[model samples]
Target: MASKPGILTEWPWTRLGSFKYVVLAPWAIHSTYSYLVKDTTQRDLSNFLIFPMLLSRVLHNQIWISVSRYRTAKGNNRIVDKSIEFEQVDRETNWDDQIILSGLLFYLASMYLENGSHLPLWRTDAVIWTILLHTAVIHPFAEHIAYFALFSIPMLSTVFMKNISIISMAGYLTYIDLMNNMGHCNFEHIPKWLFSTFPPLKYLMYTPSYHSLHHTQFRTNYSLFMPFYDYVYGTMDKSSDSLYENSLTRKEEVPDVVHLTHLTTPESIYHLRIGFAHLASEPHKSKWYLWLMWPVTLWSMMVTWIYGRTFTAERNVFKHLKLQTWAIPKYNIQYYMKWQTESINRMIEGAILAASDKGVKVLSLGLLNQEEGLNSSGELFLRKHPQLKVKLVDGSSLAVAIVLNSIPKTSQVVLRGKLSKIACSIALALCQGGVKVYTMREDEHKKLKAMVSNEAGHNLILSQYGTPKIWLVGDGLSEDEQKKAPKGTLFIPFSKFPPKKDRKDCLYNSTPAMLTPKHLENVDSCENWLPRRVMSAWRIAGILHAMEEWNMHECGNMMFGIEKIWKASLENGFRPLTTSVDPKPN
Candidate 1:
């Protein structure tokens, strides 16, 4: 939205939401009906293609949006080097409005333009030209002509051109969209040597840096695709060439810490920073409307199977320290599959080695990537590459600290579900801290009692008897068991993924997390199920590991001092969440 929004600034079909595509459905159906029922000579190919072409434009713009957001976040060759806050995201969310407007205009132009139904062809009929040029060597020549129509002679609108073939029109429209997206993407991919080879090309084609000035300065460099008009009107920005040169010379960013994570669910794809802005700004959860996109979601799952490499999900800077987040292609369930163990380990190993080569001080394995069953909490990578420079962190120390701090000192805690390293550590710490730790499972109680001294072990009770209000839960906590808890019982989770909330009267908390300091920049979105500006303890631990300049790796059987980490976190300005989280249960 602009500073002062006015009439027509928003699309009339805005209230229609996602179903706004229905506005073009009648034209599409009528065009198809006419093409199929009419005689061969009377069939209008241009009119029939209007709907599909408009849809293609929508998809093209979407590709640019995703790619631009991803690239800018990575901070490689960025033109403007400015932050894209939630306001920028909301303002740009309606980028497809132009495509919708053009589709309606295309319909009206077909009725008023001369020979609208039977326009002249380039060399032959559209059908033959499309086939011969696509199958022969003339496709490149036709694209050059389209570029001329787009860059040199910008007045030629495909919707109004009476002397254009359908094939040439498609090419022209594609080239125009490609250039338009490139100019506004805020990423510099054009090389400086290209201008040196052909100096006149600088004025003919616009670069991202040139357009970035138009956005920032707002008074000059107003040309759309070409800078020729700016040059003619003497409105060309003075720093265009220098900015382009600087952008080309810029290098990719190097970070002090990297958190390696994976997809939590199939629907989490939409909650990525590179995905929908509205969804990313909030905690990740399933949406009812997402079921309508099941086909696309399924396709994305299939694509991830083959996308074996890691990708940058986010980048943030706090004070003098730089941080980054990289995501493995696998999902949460995939990490549990026995067959995927080897492949998953290979990906994690590769990412660790890559981060080491890039001079990253610490690499943290987040979520299921540190599952003991998968890689022994990242010990396999250490064994394979013992000489690696980057320290691997599982963040178990801080995770347990958060769980211990969350339990109310007055309430007895009922420890439930599958016992793991962190669960055992939390139980041990609570016993030492004089907090009663009760277990529903007899085997878990015996295992925990045997680990501590007789004095501390007295606090571990083996029974489902007491009605403890504070429940320290882990994965595999059944819904039936949760139904047994008292009303208003608070369930604090130690596991990475939270448990299901089966009882309405019972309260649940998000997995171990802490409130981030105001110094963290570009934190517009929540970290998975955690609340806004509240980061996962594991993530904050990695950042603290780098900031404290700790050289030791915290993976395998190693456990850092919990009290020390807690004090360091508080001293570094990462506060505990004052409010309890109650997100929709998984």
Candidate 2:
């Protein structure tokens, strides 16, 4: 919102929230139904085109947003180094409103225009001379006048030029929409050679840096799509060319650390930092509209498979260290497939090798990317490339510390789940700390007993009888087993993913995560299922390893000191969250 939001700042559908598009549903359905039902010769093409035109504009803008965000996060060829706060992102969310408004205005104007339904896209009618004359005379006035006056261009052009067509006006509006998104994309993509080769092109085309100056300076470079008028009136920014040149010459940044992760759900793609602005800023969940993009989701999966490379999901700076989050193209479901095991390991190995070659100090695996069943928690990567310098971490130690700290100071806690390294570590640590670890199954107890000492063995008792208030859980925690727990039992998860909330009566703690330090820059998006600005213990473990200049690998069977990591986290300004869980309606 603006300092004081008014009609200009807020949209008419502001109160509708996610269902704001419902306002356009009637028009869309009617147009789609009409177009399909009617014969080509009998169809009202102009009316039907309006709805699809709006959709095209939306798709066009979204392409710019996703590409711009992905490029900017990579920090290569970025125009403005200034951070785009959530306020800017939230404001940009409504860029579609202009598209909707333009379509509506075009439809209204078509009603009055001569032979509007049969207007050709372009005709070398005598209207060109009139358009040029009006642009030269009325353009400067419109630029200085109220912004709403800019809307008068299409109306004024059509009123004067009888030969002008709706399609031609529509084409002009599309040009405006394209230039608007491109100017604010915050990246330099236009080649400088074009302007040098044709000096006149400099006056005709405005670079991203040129418009960036108008936003920062607020008094220069006011031209909408052309720099010609701005130059004529002495409003062109002086630093525009310099910023453009420097932005183009900017070098690609090599991060100090990288976190390797993968997508969870089909909708998880939209939750990425480079995806939708509103969706990315919140905890990941299935949006009602995502089902409508089933085709896009499938297409994205295919594209990822074909691309066969990692992409930057997020980038951040903590103190002097540059951190990046790179995601493998595979999804959680694909990782569980036997057919995908070799392919998945190959990608992980490639990423590790690339990070080592780039002089990255640490690279951490997240989500199913580090599963023991898949790669023995990243153990396979080391066997293939033992001489790599980049320290690979599974982040299990910090995750263990966070889960341990989240548990209340109870004498006994129920431990249940499929046996994993994290779960085993938590059970043994609790036992060694004199906390009784009760197990329900004999097999799990025997497996855990083999991993612990005789002194701590007594603390690990086989009994599911008591109503333990604290339950240390992991994957394979079924709803029926959850029902067995007493009401008000606090379930603390030791895994990367949270369990399904089956018992409302039972309290569920989120997967291990901690509040990020204030100095962590560019933290606009939440990690999957974690609260806003809260970093998962596993993700933070890699960052800590990099910052501490640790020269050891924490992946595979290797481990770090739990207390050392926990103490370093606090010392480095990373605070603990009291509780983490999937956000639910009150």
Best by lDDT: 2
TM-score of each: 0.87, 0.93
Using TM-score, give the best candidate's number.
2
Which sections of candidate 2 miss by over 4 Å?
1-4, 29-43, 112-118, 126-148, 580-586
lDDT of 2 by residue, 1-586 (tens): 2587555555778788877777777766776697789887777666677777788778888899899989988888898767655666666677676666666555665556555554545566524643463354222342212443564565456555665555655565566667778899998999988988999988877888888998899889888667889888899888988899999988777999999999888789999988898898888988878999999988998888777588888889889999999999888889889998999898888888888998889999999989999999998888878898999999999998888887766788899998888899889899999999889889999999999999999998898564687888899988888888877788888878899999887788879899998899888888998878899988999999988988899988888999999999999998877854422311
Clashing pairs in 2: 510-580
Q: Write the per-residue lDDT of candidate 1 for residues 1-586, one digit (tens) a residue.
A: 2699777456788889767878888878888899899999988888888889998897788788779878877778888756656566666666676677677766665656654555444534443433333221111123323433334232133224334566666675687789879988888999888988999998778898998898899888887667877887899999998888888877888889999999889999889888777788878888888898899889999999986578988888877888889999898889878999889888988899999999999999899999988888888888888898999999999998988887665535789877888998988888888888888878888899889999999888887654787788998988778877877788889998888878888788879999889888877666898877888888888998988988999988888899999999999999986536432321
Q: For candidate 2, give the lDDT of residue 374.
A: 92
Each model's lDDT comes to 0.80, 0.81
State the local distance difference test value for candidate 1.
0.80
Q: Which stretches of candidate 1 lie over 4 Å from their true place?
A: 1-4, 29-43, 111-161, 288-299, 580-586
